[model samples]
Target chain A: MIRSLAELKAQAKELGPRRCVVAAAADPVTLQALSSAQKEGIAKGVLCGPADKISQAASKAGVSLDGFEIKDCPDEEAAIVAVEEVRASGDFLLKGHLPTSSFLGAVLDKEKGLRTGRVLSHIAILEPASLGRLLLVSDGGMNIAPDLVTKLDIINNAIEVAHSLGIEKPKVALLAAVEAVNPKMAETLAWAQITQMAARKQIAGALVDGPLALDLAVSEEAVKIKGVKSDVAGKADVLIVHDIAVGNIFAKGLIYLGGAKACGIVAGAARPVVMLSRADDAETKLNSIALGAVASVV
Target chain B: MIRSLAELKAQAKELGPRRCVVAAAADPVTLQALSSAQKEGIAKGVLCGPADKISQAASKAGVSLDGFEIKDCPDEEAAIVAVEEVRASGDFLLKGHLPTSSFLGAVLDKEKGLRTGRVLSHIAILEPASLGRLLLVSDGGMNIAPDLVTKLDIINNAIEVAHSLGIEKPKVALLAAVEAVNPKMAETLAWAQITQMAARKQIAGALVDGPLALDLAVSEEAVKIKGVKSDVAGKADVLIVHDIAVGNIFAKGLIYLGGAKACGIVAGAARPVVMLSRADDAETKLNSIALGAVASVV
Candidate 1:
């Protein structure tokens, strides 16, 4: 299994280079990361944007785009061309130097977009310096406030990503404020329902448990102290939150306060979609590229 | 200002000893923490429970109870007696070895309880090892899912605690998944409303801003990167979450993964309530007692 981000990059390198198509590829940071991934033999670059703007970005980033294929186009039509390129022969997609709405608009276009009849969700893969392993948290960026059915799709997407990382049967934990089902807290009720559904084989290929607090989901000592009996209580492979705020805040808390290294990708799409934020560091962007390359193979 | 948990404990010691009454005080860890606090001149212990059980607990904890005042009572009436004692002369209340429902039942009693016509919320004070400062998170333990009105109460309670810690005007951040007001995300709408209310003087004594992601709330680099312009974008003293799940997960993620030292107390009560969980370590229990003693004075 890929236990760390370093191992993930190594695995991606071993899988050979995959084609990464970047829409509106005029951001210096995106060019730098893609250049690094190409140099490391993890991805082949396909840049789609205005030629002058792409040249200016590559010069600003101090990267040489010698072997990369460039598709010159207008700024408004960059996303369309990039999506079409990925549909034809490219392996995955990346968002760069464009509004998220416009980038997603092209990807979600009815007749020409990459659609799999599934809800789109964001998954964050983190390797906290103190935890000694990789952890997956989902729906932190894509879904705002997901309902029960959307949460099920988010869990399924996370499980698929985990399988691609060589975890055959991931233990999924539905996070809540407390372990018990409180009627006043609506998320707990949904988690309980999902747990039952997973037990009955409605959600297959994972051992799913619900309504666990953050401590019980990760710490064996907390599980023993609380006397919680569950297969995923202390050794959760994936954490699924009810809404975007919880997952977003929780993952960022680990990164900012806990010194965790993290990378994120959007799942439940036709191909892996790497969405890098401006605040993400260089390491996180490169790790995300490697993660997308690995998940694209699956 | 109290920049760290160590400073918080020192300030509590300088404020002299406050009378702390623990309901059903037959837990070894609680006795140990109370004994340490008493030795440090942070608290004067008033143990309210069965005499034999308290004695056995003290012995198990290897602590001396010579200076403590023992209120011998039956197991069923311990919470009632403890509440009445705190109402009569004690400074604050603590939950020792009883069910939380019963303990809260006594505190929320109509006739002889610690009620101030305000809603109760939980506030956690954390000092992440890397941050070099203390952060306050609210409504993580007491309120499950709070509406806008309850959030107002929670923010006011946090501001009061901050004032006691020497911050005259605390910067409060209403945490959400993102900074923008996305109509699909219900919490952003509520945060925008709260921000306007704070500006209108409906919520006083704090510079309140909203809809900030975790990174934007704490990291100046993130604020500069995103070009976010807000008074509380990067230096938030108090973070108010919309629900218990977000706050709970965020706080625990800091403690377990970030190597942070944390302590929590329930606010919006007549007196601060220290409610330690079984999963808490000895240092956390002691820190909580010191926190309760400090907040009780306000």
Candidate 2:
């Protein structure tokens, strides 16, 4: 139901301020976005990086970080220590100037990571022109070639995100090449299994079905015409893709070619994480921040 | 280059009159579309069905088929005979008032069917709002888990159709989840092989590259920023998909969600074949007939 960034901001305000910890927060764009979020009362930031670099970025970006906490960490290791600090202090995590591998390593660090024994996934919430509601596309940025069990985790992570968005019993579509189970297509096989699990009440609080094409999943008319019987077809809130590559392209297509508005996050962690791309516009970044803040509370 | 159906009609005029054989052509929509085409001198139809039924439908649709050829045949054998007649005399084939199974059975029959050894593939030519030129999406309606060879066939089929549309040396993007040649993703591996084949000149008359996500393939800015190099990156004319379901959904997404105009055909066969969907508009069906007529000549 969230239409624009302004609406998301209004929603976020009602949820109060969320505390966020930035790992290796030395990048100008990163600092700018975080500072903007903080100034807008969307989130309160705890910047973790080299103290001097963080201030320089803040100054260069023309963002005043007065009264905001800045935790000085020499490098990535310090970022990890700061991550631990913020996690214990009830603040969400964000990546900054650090390499993606290093940042993720710290988050997945067996002993000190934010893992709750669930497979981590990324979900992109897209507002396309052809639809009246938001669409949740999952695992496009994470979990490549996940097994059936891992897919369960991915679906659950996306469902949790949908639940946070106030969609009770979110409809989930397991995407495949065809709507029928085929021995050759592993995605279809997995989709069938997943649909069965949801039907048998193994996976609770979601109406699940597949293997649906993109059209059948989103268009109720297409569903009726195609004679696809399921609770999720034509009104899918979540589209659980077969692989990272499919999800990645599917979500990106909605944005670049389909003229859609999108915001993304790394889900299945203990806390909601904002993971906006650097090339994303100000609105997208802010929308994602708002989503992270609201989702964290939910 | 066609922004709408009106533009497509203008283009169809220059392509000359296409010979179309409509099987079981007793449907009012089909007759109306055919009459419109005839009035514009874009197509000449050979209607095959019960003669009385065809005349009644034509009259009801406010069409006079005085100049059109009506080949009398029973309802049960009309589809097969029409396909055979077209295969022998006409340039293209159109579907009307027949089950898909029956029509496809005749087209795929080894002895009398139109078979060229290559796997029959469906190509949806879309004109997206974000794109200046047409986008050819393939295997959405046919082919399931195409192995490396079948994928090559699909690519070849799409390339052939694009070539018939006057696109010499089309830029083909073999789509996947990512741009890298990841061994874990089977689609990427196939794309890498296909790319190599194109590089070695095994796949001729096209510039092929892959494992590109939809964004990188269509957005030159994304390709430049990501440092992904390929001739087909930003100007892909043909999109060789991984599977039928994905291709189908992708094409439909462009149409329903992105407001794209497209003409579909089953390519790599003995002759150009039109297979317009029931969901398609009159213009879409007419454009497909035009495409079939043009492809048949090549």
Judging by lDDT against the true structure, name the best candidate.
1
Question: What tens digits encode model 2's per-residue C-alpha lDDT throughout A1-298?
Answer: 4544466678787777788888887778877887778877888888888889888988888888785688887875755865686578845777787778788788878888887789779999888885888888888888887999899999999988888887888999988766878897788888988888887999988899989888788888888778878888889889888777677766777688878888988887787777767668888888888888877875
lDDT of 1 by residue, A103-141 (tens): 999999989999888888999998877677789999888
What DockQ values do the models have?
Answer: 0.84, 0.57
Each model's Cα RMSD: 1.5, 2.4
Reference-based TM-score of each model: 0.97, 0.93
Q: Score each candidate by Cα lDDT.
A: 0.92, 0.81
Give the clashing pairs for model 1: none
